[model samples]
Target: MGVYGRRRCFAVLGLATALAVGALSPAAASTGAGHGAVPAGLLERATVVDLQTAMHARLLTSEQVTRGYLDRIERLNPRLNAVVRVNPDAIAMARRSDAHRRARGARGPLEGIPVLLKENMNTADRQGTTAGATALLGAQPAEDAFLVSRLRAAGAVILGKANQSEWSNFRGSDLVDGWSAVGGQTHNPYVLDRSASGSSSGSAASAAAGLAAVAIGTDTDGSVVYPASATSTVGIRPTLGLVSRTGIVPITSRHDTPGPLARTVTDAALTLWAIQGADPADPDTAAAAGTLPSDPRTVLRRDALRGKRIGLWREGHVGVDADVDRVFDAAVRRLRDLGATVVEGADVPDLGEVTTEHMLPAVLTEFKHDLNAYLGATPGRHPRNLRELIDFYDRHPDGHDHLLFDMADKTDGDLSAPAYRAHREAATGAARRAIDDPLVRHRLDAIVTPTSLPAPVIGRERDSAPFAKTTTHAAAAGYPHITVPAGYAANGLPLGLSFIGTRSSDAHLIGYAYAFEQATNARQTPRYLPTTR
Candidate 1:
């Protein structure tokens, strides 16, 4: 039998063993203890604009900013397990940034900012690009991801790599969203027993807990937006190809894109602008050339939504949680009060059948093809292909490093298969039509929905009933999706209001999201409570 059959057998046997020993405790499995007291006012919720002003006024050095964040990470990360590794060179890098500002003034928009990267983004630094996998622990790429280089050139200090869902949550069906064997489980900052969501778990949690000024994450589907919603942060999944994917770990080249998660829409917009550009290494980025605005911040007006037609997508006939629905309705009312014309039940063609039949199969084929290409290019002694990765797991069946899910199923079929090709084409076509037809029909500027239900309890394998289905539509259409904090649930959990626009409509989407954010001003910093009572 191949790895799937072996995995089934091992799981059956291991279930008993795991139960006997009891599944790993979140606290006991953590790497270190929480340390340091919380920082003083404004620092916790300070935006990029605030930090820039402080630096320009000589009120704070980059080193001091970096050290403060490092202290926050040291204090909070152990409990949240958000950051995977702290960069040894971070202080030194900040010192260099300080020197540059003193000698030549601010280099660019992101000058002297501290940003954390999702672990999957390759950085040719002291930190490793592990993707939260022990097997690839020491695998460092020869250069930084195109986006990371852009951040460096803009004078942002690279704080370090944040934890991620192992292999971007493609390893198995039973895999927990935010739990990676390499990093344990990342807990929500608001409530320690709740999940932060993943595979962008660390990036979102870090931003929410004030461990970093901003964080970068990659989204295949809901990885970035869902986690941002869970943590009450702003996440922007820009139009695919708007940001280069080269030098980052791959899941599917077609659906994969880097995004920004920050405490405010302005900060997220600034980070998006800094990283977006055409790169020859990734030919898809050619489409984004001249399409994006010169500065997305220019569109951050409180009046941006005035006279715009916004679609309120109520999941059609599907039911959502009563509390979540109540919050979403309030958000729509707020939009109307802000001068946006809200269109209820906008007639978007449903792509549910297409997603059920085609999306997963296409993802499976793309994962095998694209990941092998990425692995082949990397310099490492680790598994070079999906098959080798499965074999590595097989060798450690009973060890702490054993795989939680079988990847062999994803590698089962060849990309050349006619079934796979047909599904891929059908899914892409359906997704585009589903989103585009609605906008054209309704004359809508954007579509709005809840980014997700309140985050689920931690350690649960999946989210409970009433999950949001909107992310698939945007992800498959390769459109821009922005999520801003809407309100808190009765349980004190946060919910997000998503603004999704057609492909290459990132500037408009950001404008709308920023406008709503300015109007609502709903996001609240986490209290880091032990748990929800």
Candidate 2:
């Protein structure tokens, strides 16, 4: 779902609530424990349901829940380095929430919930709008991103920001997935030595470790869902524009959008609701609002598949990790038992090769323009353009801008302004046709495929840098992508099943995820063991 942990192109952008990380007992928070304990009055260990229950019960104050997550971050962040810089002021905000609850009574579903966000997502508060760059490390947006405001309106406590691949890993090749100049590298919660796929590495890792109940992350390509797949969590890449992109760091305007990462489907849904809406700041929403469903919660029925036609992408079965395949097969069986008509086939059209042939150029061009505007617009930022920002990185010693193992010269990658418009039109138009014609031809609900290749072999696996070109196809089309936990690999890493749909069908797409989540209930908490054996 990403190309970014959530950054750059200067225009790069991006919440809080009073919510607890959830029902984990103090003992469960201990990595040494055999079974993690789920505490009373919070979300059930891996789902959003109990978090709502706990907040409603008044058994836990938002401050109590926020403190619990902050406590976990204190205990675990040193090892994982997932959070770039936590807001020192978060606890105070929670205390205020607690006082409000005590005096005025509870407010809403997330009255006392805490949620973390990717650093690139702008918060008007103490956090900087760096986009993983040392150049912008001191810059904070003049105002909260629209999505963050929504979360605040919902009574969420703005927890902290997570680390990500610098510039969302858009600096050419050989960029490590979770490394950011501001935060450094984010280690996988399940395996410290192994890679956590970007650009939402921090969101996935922290959530997997139970550092927070839910987090906001942006996905351009596989950024959100892939990390969830790699980390064994649920990542939803909402349809383009379902969530406003008024302040998110840019790749291509078409594909860049923020999303949610959580232990379960319902949690993602909760986060999604808080963020989804039209914003006057971004014109994209005018079209998006028309295409999106009004209320997803009602349509998210547990037995949704009881009388439905479901098609499984057979492409995922081949060359997949054995453990991941095992979970996938079992998940399919469960869907069948839930009363679905299941169809399995390797029949996806030849659109696979389109990723490289048509999309990468669009991102490169759009990135230059979008980033410049973002940098110029940010309240305290000094760099006015991509070249200036890159130059700033070179002069600064902080690791923020020095990400790629071989940083391509900015001069080589920079495109003239006209290129952005020409490239955008060609790429987006093609993508729209490819997505629409196929869905209309097949008369399908959505197309399902593996969220990512099987989770890489732990220490035994090789870490390959991603291609900038890879994410463009989807980004250009502005379609929605949803990834659900299908099963686990033999090595125990989770496998994500992605559902791609026509533009603006985010609710319908997430509905399938919600239904499937209820049907399979396959999500698992991380063990955080030193070794997988």
Candidate 3:
């Protein structure tokens, strides 16, 4: 099995019923919530823009919103298993934010906002950076990940750590999507017994459940976008070099990136702008020196999709379920209504070769090399390398899966290995061409497809649904890909529409997604349903 099969990206078959429009309205626009009168369900549907506006107008305070999120997490996290640790200093940070705002105006886009970090990110704080592995239970890093530092500098509160798949879902051959030894399974908030579709599982679920203003997730392949699709949130896998990866638990340095998940595209874009830039530590970020915009939010107009050409990518394992196809078809029609030209048959070439021959080998080989480097640099009495980590799991094997770790241990962690270099070059070249060629030939601004099938039942046998082929090509090419809430399945599970672009087109893709989101309003707040029936 390749990355898709190992990660369990398949969804269960269900009835095909499309929802019309799904923006959640405030229960009460004037309700007292410890601060001034605040809108009820503020945490559930409030955007960062909304929160900031409310705070600036003195209708809400930073402390009130922070406490509100804390209360929600306290109530909902037990059932969802999305959070692994709560920052003991989160409320203090929020009060400090209030003080700062009281002295000077708000700091930036994320000022006074609470954000969750995936457990794989090293935060140099009270929480453990375990990557959901108990082997590194007490291990800590010397400093926050580069992006986390940027977030703090922007005056955002470090809310807590969200659980993720152990070792970012590269630990075993038969790994469940959201299962981790340290944090247990993450239940999809839309349907509690369904898969959250991780490595970035908890981040998506928390964003969907309004556990924080937004959450950061690390994507190697489908980790960020896949989970966001399953949870009816927006996820952006930026150009790999756009975000610094220093201090993150690695699957492959070439493909690893931290991205934001939120209930709206504008919020995700704002969070991405705050956390993105060049880093002295991760030299790969140097490639992004001039690629990013002054602000991604400048392109947030509702008519930003007007006159743009979009390629419809429905080839090779993309159209999986009848319901998902119906949802995607409606999304394409909406795009046309919004004045985008949708060109059909924009398939990536040789997808099979990219998945099997190139992507798998490079992922396996680089995981060993990159993870060993990260482990060596991290502080504490834990596994020093992949080999040691495999032994650690061998000693404590309950709920831990390390078959992939064993595979990595057998390989010499040498980047210059003859086959390794060849595979990496071949994979990068082919995947890049797969995305770039389609865009150039179609004269397209972006490629559109169904992000994934709707959320599948947890631990259920894989059905015959064709695998959704959305994230891998963008991941391998180190390009930008964003997934937005397109619609829902009959079971109330969310479906996503993806927009993929060539290298460093993050701003344009975000603009396109934002427009679609505004036109469709397709993301409803989760119902926490026990089952579809």
Q: Judged by TM-score relative to the true structure, which candidate is superior, 1 or 2? A: 1
The per-model lDDT (C-alpha) reads 0.81, 0.67, 0.84
What's the TM-score of each model vs. the native? 0.89, 0.83, 0.92
lDDT of 1 by residue, 271-387 (tens): 988899999999989987775778564677789999999997775423668778888888989999989999977745677678778887788778878877787788867888777
How far is 379's C-alpha from truth in model 3 (Å)?
1.2
User: Where is model 3 more than 4 Å wrong at Cα?
Assistant: 1-40, 317-319, 461-464
Q: Please, what are the lDDT tens digits per residue for candidate 3 over residues 1-533? A: 11101222111100001001112112211122243322346678777876776555444567777878988998899999999999998988988887787678688878889999999998888887999988898687999999999999999999999988877878887778888888999999999989999889999999999999999999988899999999999999999879999989999988989999999998898898889989999898998876766855467778989999999988754546888889989999999999999999787766676667867787888899999898999999899988898888788877646788877777776899888888889898888999999899989999998888888888651553667567888999999999999999887899999999999898899999999999999999999989886
Q: In model 2, what is the error at residue 511, expressed in angstroms?
A: 2.0
Off by over 4 Å in 1: 1-39, 316-319, 347-350, 398-419, 461-463
lDDT for position 465 in model 3: 63
Output the number of the lDDT-best candidate.
3
- Rank by lDDT (best first): 3, 1, 2
How many clashes does the backbone of model 2 have?
45
Q: Per-residue CA lDDT of candidate 2, range 118-200, in tens?
A: 88888887877676756677676888888988888877788899888778877644556887777887877766766678888
Models sorted by TM-score, best on top: 3, 1, 2
Predict model 1's lDDT versus the native: 0.81
Candidate 3 to truth, TM: 0.92
